[model samples]
Target: MSTNTENTNAATKRVSPTGLDLDKLTDWLAAEHPGMVAGELSATLITGGKSNLTYELTDGTNAWIVRRPPLGTIMATAHDMRREYTMADALRGTDVPVAKMYAYCGDKDVLGADFYIMERIDGVPYRYADELRALGEERTRGLSTELVGTLAKLHSVDPAQVGLGDFGRPEGFLGRQVKRWKQQLDTSKTRELPGVEELHAKLLATVPAKSAAGIVHGDFRLDNVLMGPDDLPAAVIDWEMATLGDPLLDLALMLTYQRRAKIVAGYETTDPANYDVTLAPGYLSTEEIMALYEAESGRKLEGFGFHLGLACFKLAGISEGVRYRHINRQTVGEGFEDSGSTVPLLIELGLESLKEHK
Candidate 1:
């Protein structure tokens, strides 16, 4: 039988979704964080996450977010709840807005995997252009500005000052990142992808010298952040891929997403309905974004072309992994139907990005 069929059959025997054990979780929380729950605990899966599983928990009087690893086999270092919790807790008093962390449970017996809980911030994670279009150009521009500014603010903080000095090794970060993503790509590959191996080889050959180390959000993008009513970033969620590394990598990844948004929106086509949020009127152009970051952080971005090329490679690997999961029926929620189609396009974009760099 296909993996999807096996997974579907397996799910039928389970009480809750893959990684959640609602009743046991409720009991554990009551014992550990008494009075935190006022009634019976219930959970609803929160979609839009492509890595770790996120669930919205409620006790009728309160709401919380629970994050844990996805079901089935996973990379050991990837979906670490402790890492996410530590970073969020460390950034509490800093300028970076993060959800308030409540607890982290490493015992797998509690819910079949490690998990963490945090107070849910009230804001919207704007995923598409339709949401931003309703807000109009002015508000969308303001929101985009806040998004970029928030990232700069995050990179400005000293990791040592935030008690995350030992979080990750920054030395040789760029080289390791190249190898790491290449391995991820190999593991996720289901078929031969033209230009993907060539792009990987090019990225390895052109790894740039490491810049000063700072906290890098490995998957920085619009949908990853929660925007408040004032068009400002309320909280930067999804820190699972965060670590200390070259801050320029973070900037490049954000730009890559911006470029991908355009690609997904069909820049060559006149399909108005295909527009992405990044294509919304008044959103900052690529040049404007670079300038804004430079001005805000007072950091001259040297060797940025190399970083952008590598960003494309990294994102291509990520997209391929998502596509693999979707094909296996291991993905949660809607919108995954077209995920596999983006893989080849992203690989092609990665090659094109490197050519431009040369």
Candidate 2:
């Protein structure tokens, strides 16, 4: 059976699709593009991509990436191709790095699921802490700075420039986030867990007092930032989570200070090869990342405390959702050995964040 993916961001979900039993991918390619004689499709099973099935494809000489919803019952409506396409299209002339889209296939008849193909961007994803450390001090510093800078550029982009104004519900965004995730977690309840409710209440009481809504990389973490030859960020992938909202919350999601404290997943490093991402000693501090926004975007850095708290809350809910999958026997791959302790650690992290921001 195919693996199930955990939901880590609001609105964007990782799910394995159902009845995708088509080896006809080659036939479709051949007929659609005429001269392009597509042969046997090679699916390089890329793991750690909990929600999407990413296949690195090659049509004889040319390479492309195929992405489809994971196999299973997904909660939301049809996949948001409009949103994903928007980010890739918008990044065309911007400083932010994104894959150049080749074509988007919405006809589920072709592949038993809707999928898209984009020119494969080359770079390695890190799976080990040591690998991040091994990038050496110099490369790691550059990697960290560039990663932060890429996010800064993403937030600074003019939504009007890319015709993406119809993306999200901007007003009262922070106010609704707490309740939104709380309801999701509640509905997916497989266990009677405590402190989850309390965490939501604490977060709702302190939504960010101010926000600079922009093109937010909803899941801007080290893993999402693509690293080039010398550990420099090539492009940020996984735009299913991208939205227009408070950019600082996006920053905090990347840090994931809370999720680290509380454990989830079979192992922290799914792939040991390139998972080592070192946060440089002088990389943008929480305060500095926010300050840079103030100077560049003209959005005051007020209620930063609230944003930090919300980030922690979001991570906790995400981890808990993954934990729920494990309990229900719906998760793929392996289960964590230290789950008993992991859940508590996450709750504590959420509570600690609340106190810090308060």
Candidate 3:
């Protein structure tokens, strides 16, 4: 997990990992994308992904990526392959860098769940602070600035112009988000978190008025962006949570992660899902990130504290879900063993953010 992730291209004679069938996948690709299979396919489950199951597929000649839901029970509304594929497909010609979507397979018979194929872009997702620090202060600063700029550019895009006007209902997005996360937490609840109810109540009471409607990369963080050799974001992957919503929510989440990144770096902790590269020596500060986003997008942030609180609440809900899966033996990859410990801290952070902002 974290910066330790790398796609190993070494050819191996092995069976497909859990939740994927290489032979069936080859058949589907040959039918859907004719002549793309080339030879017998091999797939390795890509690590560092905490939510969706990502696999790097190769047919001895070409390499592609397949994204699907994790094996075992998943939330009905979560892990939408079509939604992820649609967002990336729509953003092809936009300033937001996304991988090239080749095809989408919605039939459950093909992969036991909806899935999509996209051309693998050779880019590095720097997940740890040290990995970014290794790039030296100047390069790290530039990459971090580009990361913020890419998000601002994403917020500047008009969803209607990109054929994603109806991607999500922005009219009551904030309210629905609070309620949705509460419901999500309910479904994944395993233990009584002390501050969960208080955080939920605070978020529900402090819903911010919508500012601007645009694409919200629901999970906007350094690890989610793939950096090319030139220190620019080559592609923004993991759009399973992307949708039309208040763009400021994305900013708040990014800020919250940066704060957490600083804490992680300070404590020298190893929470893969929460690591952020912004804590590197020369990365942008939270204040600079907000100012740069406001300047680049021309959208002044209002009621940002509420957005930050909501972001923490949403993250708490998500972490609780991950904790639930880990306890039930349903999670994939490493670093999930510590998920249960973050929920209460996230809830506490949400409450504190609300109080401080208020």
Candidate 4:
């Protein structure tokens, strides 16, 4: 974990030589993964990841990525690396493409916290469908369609059937969202902003019905995926927040990224266009996807209002926590500083979506 609170006055915060330092990192990589013994090894910290510390390591010819918890005190169940590896490894041979996992480490002596190494994906995928428009709108739309279509495939997967029976509760996913995110907000909180508690209370009163529970990628966005040079998605990264939930919530999160409503740190301006990139379209419209999902899974996805509302609430909690980290200067990748106003904006978007629906 890269987050070392050296400036903190706490004793445990003073854990010297936190995690696996690079020298040991090289030795560990050499022993566990094949082909790293003879080649020179280089380790570089990947910043801008808000949650886990990601490292890019190369042993001369071969390269891989290591993901672990941030240094210092961390919530046990939340940042569990074993669980992260479990999800990533589980996706193998499935429709979902993930970077291949090389090994999972639970030994604290190897590094302070648990860590895992996986194959490194090449090239950036289309975080914004517009980023692919370098080809043209029609072609971008085709690629974008594949993305949403792939998402539908993901939502259709049976967590239990796919050998992921240990994933966790799926029966009442939408029901648990608010409580879970609220706890996250409480744990990571470092500052206060207006309307947060009020907004949360309102959400408690306004939660919509659970439509259908399925495998929801807790954090689904374009940037989370990598596209090959062919302009197609090569792999999906960051499975730490994966969960079972109302799949519509995943769609709503995708929408929020489309508009990037939360303000970022360095860029003070709130530009809706930045998020206007419909990274995936033909695959995820409420009508199109619900039709596909219901037909494929034989399940009902009726509670659009509730699902959209939950999405807004989810975004608010995430943005608020991010805003807290931003003020403290703990965030690596910038943007989302104006998360103060994202709640209202998303709620408005939800309301508009509803109006358009009617």
Candidate 5:
């Protein structure tokens, strides 16, 4: 993303609640990229991000986005700002819509963590059913169709062409995922989860043969993308978990999110409210989405049952981690109070998904 470097010496500066140092950031920008600072910086933390902290930064005239690791302990491999920046930068002219990346700062001394800036695109993230409902069923369905099509487009990209051929080891990707998540679950285990171990075992035993490899978003869902005014995707954000892997894994994760949305919408005790946008009229069903991906990518989505089962297992582990942090009071935002309630149900669903395949 290109920045307008007008360089005004205005003295207005404000720090966000997420602890971004505006003065330091402005100074660094002024030194590294002269005239980029139109005025003093003002930042506001963007809520709804569950992993890395996202902030909207504006220098009175120009707007940009800043992403940094979350506060407190983080798994070293999980939130790599450089990796995210590389992916967005590589996909700059590609059909997959991504915000224009401006700069990446690895200097931890600046913000106590690495961060990057990108263009601030205008669009709604469509996190809830009510949001899409306001847009009417036709627009919502069209948006969802675009969403699946976007995934197909991403999977169609050759990693080597984007200079990301070495981004991840696609050989044995599924096995590594199962092992990695199992270790994550072990590390984050606060209490015994009844079905999680069994589910993990099933996933390990039924690891599908890896298909053609491509860039996987790791967590692909409607909320992860920005929907434009015309019902097309303005940009896809949140690439911290992105890597090269089986493309079907991305599709499976999308389906998993659909299931989680439906589950969250039905729970009365969920705090901060939850609603399933995919349940809205016009949105494609999970089966339809898979079919669309198949048609668009021209690939057989065989053994999808295994992929879905693995996706559920992965999500359950993530929920358990949230619950662990919530119980320990380590979580940052709202809606985590009921995170523990999601684990058992996710595990059960995971087991059922595996059973369908078996």
Candidate 6:
């Protein structure tokens, strides 16, 4: 299990991660999952995630991954460990590859926050252009195709068939998404952003009348999926934002991330090591990815501009939150200082997407 993002795996005996207590965790595991622990537990914090804190745990023989919400205050609907665990657990036998869920703990007394444990997959999350380039152009293209194909397969699954019919209120989902991201931006606003307010207004006014309902991976991107040894998506890892909504929004958000990776890599202030895998040679273009998705899912993407605009707006709001955290010194790892700069860029892109798509 490799996370190419800002993660550090430092081995320190008996020293648990910042948010976890070894003694308490050991006790809970013993109570919840009997006979799982072979020896004393040692934990290592994998700190790159902005929303949820991930920790790698080992008990001499067995290794597992634990996820919990970030420290401090969060929105009511944000970082629900039970929701994430349930979604992944439901999608187990489906076309959507997900990690094998072990247990979910909603009792805050266990760890001061809700958390879940799951099998640690040994797949690589390729995050950089150079990393994919190592696999050659053909393999990169195939991986990109596999990524979109997996998304289509996921969208094709009936939520009810997976016992997720009541997972979310899909009605008026698009409108709610726009308002939710706007509220998030307002809550995290640190400085004046020129085009955000206008973009928000335009998205509110241009909400699409028709949308296809399906499970939405709110943050769909290449790095979010783990690639197996054969260069296929072994498991789609991050499920913190998974819910029932307009599936096209997932597509729009994915394309937006592709653009974001390119923009981030082009920045002069960006670290030389940072690169966008989507821009790597032989990677599928935005049109090709969409075409493959439409063909596989048999769903026409009508009024796609609004979805793209909303995706950009959502990304902007998320970036603003990152910037807010970075400014407050609440974020960990590198690249956060550049988050504020991307917000305005995302807003401008959102406005352009609306104009072009319209």
Off by over 4 Å in 2: 1-22, 31-37, 77-82, 208-210, 257-300, 326-343
Give one digit per residue, the lDDT tens place, for model 3 in 257-294: 77765655666655544446676789889999989888
Candidate number that wins on TM-score, 3 or 6: 6
Reference-based lDDT, residue 261, model 1: 76
| lDDT (Cα, tens digit) per residue for candidate 5, span 277-342 | 787877898889978888999978777777888888788767666677677765555566667577
Error of 5 at 193 (Å): 0.5
Itemize residue pairs with steric clashes in candidate 4.
19-112, 48-333, 125-227, 258-275, 259-275, 263-336, 263-337, 264-335, 264-336, 265-335
Cα lDDT of model 2 by residue, 81-190, tens digit? 55676677777878788888877767778765777777778887654456656656666556666766777788888787777786776777788777766765665565
Compared with the true structure, model 5 gives a TM-score of: 0.92
Query: Model 4 reaches what TM-score against the true structure?
Result: 0.77
lDDT of 2 at 91: 78
Q: Each model's number of backbone clashes?
A: 0, 14, 0, 10, 5, 0
Model 2 TM-score? 0.80
The global C-alpha lDDT for each of the candidates, from Candidate 1 onward, is 0.82, 0.62, 0.83, 0.63, 0.81, 0.84
Q: Rank the candidates by lDDT, best first.
A: 6, 3, 1, 5, 4, 2
Cα RMSD to native, each candidate? 3.8, 6.8, 4.0, 5.8, 4.6, 3.7
Residue-by-residue lDDT tens digits, candidate 6, 1-358: 2222321235433455577777788889899899989998877777555667888889989999999986666668888899999999999999899999998889998788999999999888787788888889999999999999999998999999999999998889999999999998999888888988889899999997767899998888888898999888889988998999899999999999887777777765655456677888889999999899999999987788999999999888777777787788765444555676777788888998887555
Q: Which stretches of candidate 3 lie over 4 Å from their true place?
A: 1-14, 264-275, 356-358
Evaluated with TM-score, which candidate comes out highest? Answer: 6
